[model samples]
Target chain A: MNHFMTSIFLILTLQFTGVSSSLALADDSIFVIAGKNSSLPQITATDLKLIYLGQKSSLAGKPILIGQNESIQESFYATFTDKDMTAINQLWGIVIFTGKTDPPKNLKSDSEVIKFVNDDENAIGYVSKQPEGDSARVLAIQKSTTTTSK
Target chain B: MDLWKNIVFSCRLFIFCLSLATALATSVASELQINGFGTVGAAASDDQSGYAYDIRNKINYYHDTKFGLNFSSRLGQKWSWASQLLVKRWVDDTFDDNKVKLDWALVSYHPWSDLSFRVGKQKLPLWLFSDYAEVGFLYPWVRPIQEVYGITPLNTITGASLNYIKQLGTVNFELNAVAGDSKVVEDRNGGIVLLANVKRAQLLTFSLIHENFLLKANLGKSDAVDVTQRTGSSSYVFPQLKYTFASLGAKVDYQTHFVWTEIVTTHVEHLSNMNGLYLSYGKKFGIFSPHITYARYWSHNYKSVRADTTTSTATTTVRVLSYVPERKNKQQSLILGLVTKITDRSNFKLEWQYIDADGYSRDTTERSTTTGGVTTTVTSHGNTKERGFFDAHPRGEVNLFSATINFIF
Candidate 1:
């Protein structure tokens, strides 16, 4: 009886550890990044929402160029905009089809996004992890009711 | 044959211009973007005498099928150019002649981050979805509720506009003002086609947007020439007419639930007064979303006068004849729809609508006349007999079912 109790405790401990680690892995954090020379140091959640919705054209009196990573767009939009990828695309269809504004430039990977942002002084982008580029800086996002960020 | 020749010529010219623009943009601009959206849809109605516009009992694709292409070029920092071309088959018989048309062509200048100016042809921003009505992938319904959208006869105008956008904390405010002119054509059962030339059109819109809520108001005015009497080789030109409209709209989205509402009133001088209302609610669950909408349209105090002229060898007389006064009509519809996202770029939608219309009559009139050397003589005339709204379905109720596949890239 003592051996059986010890084995049951060990199994429960392993199961809890495994579940927690998987949750941590699945909870990938998204970061908003801008060019090193950009005038915007940080962005509020409302402003970010407006920019993505094509309701605002700039931040801090500087023209904004938006870049997107195709790989993480689904998760990033869901987290930041509270919208799925399909919803985001539909919104873009309205904006673009109306000739109101152009959509963001789509890049294949985080490296491409980092490169695009670094080349354009007014550029902004999102990524799952911090990019390995000195020319791009991660802009701290202000906490707000509409956005969730890490 | 002449129309076909003209269509071919127009197509060739458009192709040549497109190629030229592409070459110039590739050589000068750093980037050019081309995008397109299309809908392949079919609809059927249960009314034998037809229902809602020109739809009949047969499954029809021409009434709602449409495709559009957009081209945008970024010119330097302060300037950009955009153009859109749309091909649609509408219910009107005259639209069959011009299936392909230019939707918008505008050159915009952004001198400041919050302000911009655009000049050229543009969509008349009257309602919430007016700008992108043909893009089926954007909206929640299979189509915009017809009762509200059908009231606006003009959708595009040659115009110049100024737009201002400002963000304050959690609220965003936008103002748009436009001045333009347009020509609208309407076909009345292939017997009479009215051409309206509108001038001095002006519109103003204000919107306040929160994170998930939006409030909008619009006011517009225009002067138009009623050219209906000139359709049958008549040289007489009617006087200029004036019209004004005001509308309010609101929308809310919380979690997976959404609601939208709009109300509008229009006054056409010496013709009629019109009002419309639309309400919609929807909820999203994963890749599937279902929505329901109710729309109503009412016309009050419709008035028109008909004159008759008779000529003989001895006398030519013109008499003031019958008058239609204080006529009223109303149409209401309820729609239930389901939309499913098949992929990132494709969507499939199905909708069922029940429509009830009242205060309308169907009539047929016949006139026989004889002409001699220099005088025309009136021989006989038959009066029009009023009948019910639907000959086959006497209740004036129609059921419409539609399915569409929409895609964007």
Candidate 2:
């Protein structure tokens, strides 16, 4: 019964406390990039999350999402999507087991992500730094006001 | 043979999936993707009471540990196939009858980007986390609550499912319907406790999601049979029974916080009625996620009836209806757990559970016979005790500890 009471107190305390995303993002601005020839509109954070999570097939056009398997993913996800690399992989595990969708195409580094996006007109990905010249088009992100990076 | 027909059905489905996988063979391995998940765990309890059948002072690692491999392939532009092969290591004869099994074997046709149809053996979409309930790495706990998930053994359904999804901005709406037939038996400590057979089962579910919040509602019905009370000299079988259930589930995931809850009510014609619910809250701090869950389950049987034809005359018929109270497994439990992320693909979990039982029955009423043209009605009052899950109601309480490591490849 002591445990029960302690648990109840904790539940009540947590229930009343409203928690928001605390991951700061001012230091780095990860760009949502695609091929220069692509015609994609500015996307919302939700749509970007959906596409990268393999839950959505496309946005305006048939776009193939490319994932990054490097350290940049840690900050890219934390800044844009409130989740970390571990949480992202956990979500993919369940989605794969349920036969919902296949894993996204993952590139090894920022250069690989950039090269792939520049090669395929329908390929979209995220990179730590902006692409050089006119090689790729940056998908302007419309972040929700409440979830905007601090 | 009818009692074991479900086993045969599962075997047939397994072979069907294998044959289809072989037929869709391709030299290029990348086209057919492969993914696998595994969990190794052990549990023990300090209680020496025989009531705690499997978890009494002994570290048990066989039942909770399991591994499975999933295969998925895109046949054409609109067709796809998926199959899962589950393997378990059993150190005893309890599960020797079922060493290896297939978890899912289905072919899907996406007529539209938002609509799809699948037919094969698939897991029942019963709860909030039913899809990934078995994969411990997906959840923060060592196991799902027994009060809600342990009511029956009917997890797999061999039939067809249709899903319709509509994405409106960030919010998504989905309506799913499934129809099938299945059979299974409950085995506890190598003893057959009861059996469930579904002749015709149907489920309709609707869900809505926005951001990290999800709400789901479900309704299901089955024309089935109930076989119980086999521990004594005799067993009772309620055939041609109608079982029905309705459930509501909700979950909120924002940042590192998660809250999940679900309520369900079920009824079996001429048998019993049951209600169960659970609420869980968890939060992640860095690589560790600590969580707590509270759950409860209760049941009550329908009033019984008896016919006294021996004393009936030709002019009138005598019928007696008795409202007897039957006690079943009424239980409440609290679970405290912590999940530590070892790496991106592995997790180590620990949990402490406290279970308190509250329902038991022992009849001591004596009824008068019709020896001298006398008729008596049954009584509801009985000698009551506290027992649930635990066979012996030692103190009507138990404390269990568990640890596990889950990984995906």
Candidate 3:
């Protein structure tokens, strides 16, 4: 009877832990972030697309610089722009060839992207985790119909 | 002397700017970036005489291959400057001289995301690919069709442009207005030189981009002047020739297939009216993409009249009017090509083109006549001989094959 009771307890503990971990994983969402002092409080998915595609150069009244984390670039673009890394790079080739705009600066990790945004008031970046600091603020993104969570 | 001086000055200025940029890059490193693109291509045609292809081609790399370098610098938060330098051998020249040219040097200001302004020498966006026509890696074909792109004599303009962009839900709209001037020099028949001057050129474009579709419309007008001087003390001037043009274009991309089409009409005062249409379709399969294109060029008859007055011995004046006719021509071409991406930044392309042209040229006939025991010869314009593409050589079909390797860095 004691052995059966211990087995039940182990099974219950495993089930509870699995559910908690899955919920925790689901809560870690990616976000588009900017400097705390930036005038831009929120951005739409269309605006983000234009900014990253080199169609628009600024946000609000300030010229904007774009930084991307290499680790999450594939997922970020796939989820937000409805494109893969190869497609994004091809689009940038056209943009750069036109002599109208330059490609974004690439960062090695999400922390680097956050650091870049924090250093430049006109800079914006994307990361997987919600940044915890006073230098950066997360902007509300109005999702579009095409955007899909990966 | 003035032209040479200007050229030398431009060269010196370019060198100085390049040195300064390099210095700044070494010192700061983060504010400046340099990139480049190049094409090493060779093309051949079945016709031994010549063929008017993109740029120029005669089975040689000197005429078809080109290289370019781009420099971009960020100045503060709202201002930036960029420049591009291109080097290529021209079709009209036997040797590579005057090959180094400045493609664009512009300063851009963006005060808001919706509005922007630019000034300086910039690309005249007359068509969809006009801004990046030289970047072969960005396009599927080895090169754009010459029959369509060759119609415009000017590619870049010196002036300013204003652009406004707005997004509404799933659709995006862009409106662009440009005002500029252009000067071009042409070599006629490889000998005579002609100068074309364009003034007060204005262009307006509107484009709407949706999920997988794009629609664009353009309208432009300009005042053109052409000057031709002969070896003797004779010169001709065609002044204040008005030119107006309009075009409509649409592009669709769905899954692995893409289609692009456009139609253009140009009217030139005291000259022939030209109409052009082009359609292209392509599908991607893994690393390879195959495409086909059809293009047509048509022109209407050109007519001009001149009046001459003569005085007789009795003080009577008579006026005689003479009319000149420039025959019209129609040309069509079919192009098949394949592109394979070697990597993310490089590609290889092979293309084949077949062209058909029909026109008539004036041929002279001579006759001998005897009047009052004297022999005289008379010559008149008679018989029309069939001409080839653009009234070129043997009036028949033309085949061209090209292979190119393009890359961007």
Which predicted model would earn the best lDDT?
A: 1
What are the candidates' C-alpha RMSDs? 8.8, 9.4, 11.5
lDDT of 1 by residue, B51-164 (tens): 434567888665666777787877877788899877765434354543567889999898988888999999988887788888998877777776777776678889899988
Descending-TM-score candidate ranking: 1, 3, 2
Q: Give the alpha carbon lDDT tens digit for every residue of B47-70 in model 2.
A: 754323455667766446777777
Over A1-150, each residue of candidate 2 has an lDDT whose tens digit, in order, gives 999999897875543331233544346567788878877666777787777654566567443445553645666666656666667777778677887654555566668777867766656787767778887788854332222222
Give per-residue CA lDDT, model 1, range A22-116, as digits (tens): 22214666778887776676887667777876667787897788888887666667666777667688777877887766578777777888887
- For model 2, the stretches where C-alpha displacement exceeds 4 angstroms are A1-45, A58-72, A106-150, B1-28, B49-53, B89-98, B226-235, B303-325, B362-386, B391-394
lDDT for each candidate structure: 0.72, 0.70, 0.69
The pairs that clash in candidate 2 are none
Tell me how much of the true interface, by contacts, candidate 1 captures. Answer: 0.65
Model 1 stretches with alpha carbons more than 4 Å out: A1-25, A141-150, B1-30, B90-93, B229-237, B304-317, B320-326, B361-395
The sequence of per-residue lDDT tens digits that candidate 3 reaches over residues B1-409 is 5467447545754664576567557736475666778787888777654555232235654445677777787777667888888766543322334356788899988777677788999888787677778888877777766556656656788999998878766677989898989876644333344566878889899999765677989899897645342323434455677878888888887778888788888777775577888999999886678999999887764555322333333433333333333556677889999987765567789999887876654433344444455545555664353333332444368787889998877
Q: DockQ score of candidate 1? A: 0.34
Docking class of 1: acceptable
* DockQ head-to-head 1 vs 2, winner: 1
Q: What is candidate 3's TM-score against the reference?
A: 0.78
